[model samples]
Target: MRRRHLIAGLALASSLTALSALAAEQGKPTPTTKEILAKSAPAEWRRPDPQNLLVMQLPTGRVVIELAQDFTPLHAANIRTLVRQHYFDGLAIIRVQDNFVTQWGDPNDDENGDKDKIRSLGKASKTLTPEFSRAIAAKQPWTPLPDGDVYAPEVGFSGGFPVGRDPASGQEWVAHCYGTVGVARDVAPDSGSGSSLYAVIGQARKLDHNLAVAGRVLEGMPLLSGLPRGPEPMGFYADPARRTRIESVRLAADMPAPERPAIEVLRTDSASFAALIDASRHGHNAFYPEPVGKVGLCSLSVPVRDAKPVH
Candidate 1:
């Protein structure tokens, strides 16, 4: 009887141990927020150079933009020149086209339109040669995406920027998406000077040909996007009084280092990036009903994070 009782007791203990192991295998361990962020984040995330930064102060708020140096060096330099002379301060956003762009600077855009322009181009040239698109070779390194693109033969990220390239023509230009800032020109391709510029605040207008797109507003899309559309044709405000005020436009380099906004952008090429893409497409959590298989080029949001702890 004693021997039988010992065997039964040992079996019961073994079953309990097996049950515990099964429970451990079945249970999904909850990942901490820090762990998720760390695992999802890449080590190669970079901060934009203050010198390349463009700070535009609107009546609503400040809009921070990063100029693409690799694509449009000449235009970027010209903009920097304008900023140094304080050309944009006190200027007004004269155009807010519905489902289009919100353009600022001299409302009198035509050569004959200027009566007494407050925003004068001190030393900067009124016109610049059309830098519509440039040649793209192996020399110009760009990480092409796996998915096929409708616009170009190759679509990818280059020099930490979203871009599209045509291998046949060996050319690439800035895509016309929301917040895309370009020089407004007439029928003449070379007519567009750095002075009369516009920012795209709506859908990506892929049809813009031979126009010089200088830079893009990186942070504050809403400031321009959310603006009330101009009542007149081409979204140009007929009345000057209704326009939004531009307090000032300054290069990040010009501002004191302490006053600059601290921001970090994630690098496209990294292991953590691969994981992030994977996680974003197919969610592992219970909240997600169905896993999304793919994400578009613009859909993949390059997150802008505040590096320093916010109070």
Candidate 2:
């Protein structure tokens, strides 16, 4: 009787093992984002130049921006000067117009704050030549997107920035997709001096020619995008108490090596980058049996990752 019970137990265990195997087989196999990045070669990643990197420390976290120096050189230079002069320190995020922009600068410039106490731009220029768009030439690196664009004759990326180009007009400018930082100015075209900047937190593509895109947020977009929406018109926070203050803005070059944000951005020209784009462009999963094969220009944000210091 004991031998019989032992045999029965062994049979039950075998049956349960087979059932578990079948359950595992029932699930579909899909390669995740993490898996793809893991397979990327070391050479596929590039570190941004310290000279062009802006480290904005907010109350919530650190936000890293890569200045689009190629498109807005003068604004880039002035912004760097302003950072070195510490012009952005203690400034508050004044407006968070939902689906528009998260603006920051001197609250004094706004109707809500004391205008007399506005911070000076110091040695930085008060105005710069408008860099709204530049002539697209053969010398520039080009990686055109696969699908047709709605706003421009062609859409693609160049130097890590999403670009909209008109071959006929020979003009190319950065798009105002999420995390794009633009220089705010008055009615005049050349009024932007990089003193006041706004990050694109919503669909503000209409502001393309109306403003100048100076940079793209490389990291910490959540710190800007996830903030509570302002109550006033155009998303301005009516209550000054509700605004988030800037702790400091530092050029990565000015910071100590230990203090800098060490990150690796996937090279848009690399084969791995092409693979990444193709993954989304040709992705098919259990949930999405019919692949959405075409990806929009704005949706093609290159992947960025934090990296350990080289020994």
Candidate 3:
């Protein structure tokens, strides 16, 4: 009986080894994110519309944001107006909540701040019909992830932004992924004026479908996330001196042609991007012998690169 059992175990091991060899012969492992990007075609990249690009100059470096006008046109327009009016210029980054957000706006707008010192909104509307979520448009680019979400019925990328969707309601909203920029508001839904904004330093998925996502930060996230956390509750800085001052905020359209940021973003609908998604799911290497077959909505980051000068 012992001899028979040993022979059976040996046969099973031989079969497993054969299966492994067959699998290796059938397909090569998915390329790494870096390798996939290196092979991407120039057509896979897109230059953002100047009107939708915001250049926020900070003490450390420049932070570029691309407004998702298709999702929240009103908020985008309002933010554009505020930017044109220089509403954010000279304002300070008032809060840096650990593992939450890096908020920037008029310091006087806070609970501990002097109401009288609040900066004027100028021509921008003080209140807007809250654009928390909008009806999903069929024409919009949709790169759906097979892996289901915890919050919404489905999750995907629309126009380079991580988005959550509910087919039952036909509503889609931007997910609060890392580097997502959201409009700050009071309890009242109409209170958001696009004057104050916060960038997610962590995956604050709970905020999805709750806050209006103004845009996504394309560059200079380290400058925003690397700041010291505030001593006050909710990351509000008690001492004004701790806040980082905003040098200026300008729309790319307003800048000189030569001075505009020479940058491009990988198109979410491009083949390279789809490869990236697959790579995130199944790519394996020496370090990671086993690939995690599922990828979350916020785990993917659309690639951005400095545009090569047209010779």
Candidate 4:
């Protein structure tokens, strides 16, 4: 029995060696991420719907976020109402937790602020049904990753958002990957009203299924992430002067066509995306002689491009 096992192992090793030799002879180097994106077809990119795009102007620059309405419709709608009413305008980025999140909202909403100065919610709800997760729809576009996850049964991309799923429960939620925007809430699950928001700047998978995800930052992540960390616990700015004031927050639909941002995001379900994933797992070049052979869900960022002008 021991001899038989040894023979089997030797045969497998020989086959692997032959395959390696064949691959070396082919001389086909793994394509870099740049090459993969450059070869992507036009159909593989999608323009975010104007209604779902939030354009936030800070003193530094503009930050564009794409709302995941399909995953969290209530939160998305509430955010939309708040934007239409200009609720976020003049609000401040009150927190910058190093390697965690950058938060922005009404500074008055914080513990030290004057209660009387708190901003009104306008027509938006003061509390909303917690959209932490939802029943996975059969028709939703889910491009699943091959690599496993520690937090959930499955991990994948749904409409360009990183997501985790549990097939047994038929539920899925937006993952707290970098640049993911989540609604801020109090102790109660129902307290999140989309009035306050935070963008993840580091690994925060622990937040999955705990907070209602509103959307993701399609551009201007540097504007959010490259800020000074606050002194207070949880990174709240101790001094009011430390907060970064929001210039304006406008929905793309509210802006004129010419004023709207012209950007496109690579479709998560495209062949190029699959190729990119495979490349991430197995690509090798002069710099990286050996493939990593594994990829985490958050390690990949979907590519974005400025839209080309039409003749």
Candidate 5:
């Protein structure tokens, strides 16, 4: 009788082990959320350059913008010039259209060739040639999204930046989405010079074509997202005082090294990154009721973490 009991206990233990194996095979983790992340994260996450960072002080809070040199090199360079000259030092957000963009710059420009007396462009040019789109085959490294895009023939991430491309034309442009910063211009699309600009804080306005898309707010999107709606069309506030003043826009590198933000971004090509996407699509955690089958590229929030000095 004792021998029989031992055999039954061994059978039970084997069954439990098999069940655990099955759970793991289903890509479900037995560990807590924190434990899973600790095990999944690799060491090669990137630390962004302080020189590339854009810091905007809003009345509400600070918005950190990461300039995308990969897509819009000229605009990024021009922006750096404006920043260095303190051109946007006291400029306020002149427009805020609900379900659209929040715009800032001198609104006094005479589009019809009238005399403009509000302000003068010190060093920044009043007009600039359009930097609308560029060739996709410029040997730019890109991560093609699995899901196809409606706007272009292809859509994916290149150089850690989002992009859309037309294979037939060999043309590509940065997609406009929330936190997307674009050059504001008059009726003429090519008139945008990167002086007057706006950032998309709402839905992806695909209708905006022939416009110059410059950079995006990688970190501080919430600062623009939560602003109150404007009364005017296209979100331009009628009153001047209502605009949000930009204290200064400076590259992180120009500022003292100690004052920069410490951040680390995950490498998209890493194995751990693949696992993260899988886990995110089909959430096996206790809170999930239905396991999702697919996800959009834009929906996936790129993971960013605060960096700390390794002792």
Candidate 6:
């Protein structure tokens, strides 16, 4: 009877252990990106300075851009001068290259348009020295991406911009990713005056070193990128009527304090951002049998949120 009792007791203990192991397995599912962000601390986000924010209006919607003042101070200042003068108010989106870029400027300057009617630059300069890339000093904030890049020795984020870096040459420049705003220049390298800007809507790694990346479109990217492609060569619109009109472009700081768009961008160095990256690296579920386990420089879109509204 004692032997029989010992066998039954051992069986019961084994069953309980199995049940506990099953429960532990059920509770250990990998957290998704949504879950990680939901658990993020408040301090992990930062509100962009009003001085750095640009609010642009089109017939379809508003586009918010964060000027890279630290990376391209001259260009930022030039762009600010143009905005104050309302240089972009009546201008239009003149070109959209399918899987490439959407360019906006005075319609008369392009080949299809009459150069005789080119709009005056007003207080803005006609040209400036190229700020295509800058020396990568230690003072520059870098949040390095671990994955290898095809273009450069190192790739990372600096001041909310995707950047490629070369420690050997000590040079770093913003990578040409979707929604990156680049200054359109004439044949001369220094001809870019920020009068005309192009937003990358598709893959354009080739333009990284050639053009000066001024800023990034934080909002209304779909409105710009999803527009119909131009029929003319190099994405120029043969007819001015087909171009999208620019209603206005205003600096956020220039607006009333209450009317300024309240925005908070997730800090790249935050714990949440680390989690976001790690999740992208090793996350797996029933839907995905294979985890990518690697992330590229441009694959992660920086998170920005509307903090509050005036109304």
User: Best lDDT goes to which candidate?
Assistant: 4
- Candidate 3 vs candidate 6: the TM-score winner is 3
Which residue runs does candidate 5 get wrong by more than 4 Å? 1-43, 107-117, 207-209, 284-290
Q: Answer with 2 or 4, whichever has the higher lDDT.
A: 4
Residue pairs in candidate 3 whose N, alpha carbon or C atoms collide under 3 angstroms: none
Q: State the displacement of the C-alpha of residue 15, model 3, in Å, after optimal TM-score superposition.
A: 28
* Model 3 quality (TM-score): 0.90
> Candidate 4's residue-wise lDDT over 258-294, tens digit each?
8898999999999888877766655444334454567
Higher-ranked by lDDT: 3 or 5: 3
Candidate 2: segments with Cα more than 4 A from true spot? 1-30
> What are the RMSD figures for all models against the true structure?
12.6, 10.1, 8.7, 8.7, 9.7, 11.0
User: What is the Å distance of residue 221 in model 4 from its true position?
Assistant: 0.4
What tens digits encode model 3's per-residue C-alpha lDDT throughout 92-146? 9999999999999999987788999989899999999999999997798899999
lDDT of 2: 0.82
Would you give me the overall lDDT of model 5? 0.65
89 in model 1: Cα distance from truth in Å? Answer: 0.8
Residue 184's lDDT in candidate 4: 91
Ranking by TM-score: 4, 3, 2, 6, 5, 1
TM-score of each: 0.79, 0.89, 0.90, 0.91, 0.80, 0.88
lDDT, residue 277, model 3: 76
Query: What's the C-alpha lDDT at position 116 in model 6?
Result: 88
The TM-score between candidate 2 and the true structure equals 0.89
- Clash count for candidate 6 is 0
User: On residues 205-256, what C-alpha lDDT tens digit does candidate 5 reach at each position?
Assistant: 4733477776777677777767777666666666666667777777887888
Model 1, C-alpha of 45: deviation from truth (Å): 1.7
Could you tell me which 10 consecutive residues in candidate 1 have the lowest summed lDDT? 10-19
TM-score: which candidate is best? Answer: 4
Count of steric clashes across candidates, in order: 0, 1, 0, 0, 7, 0
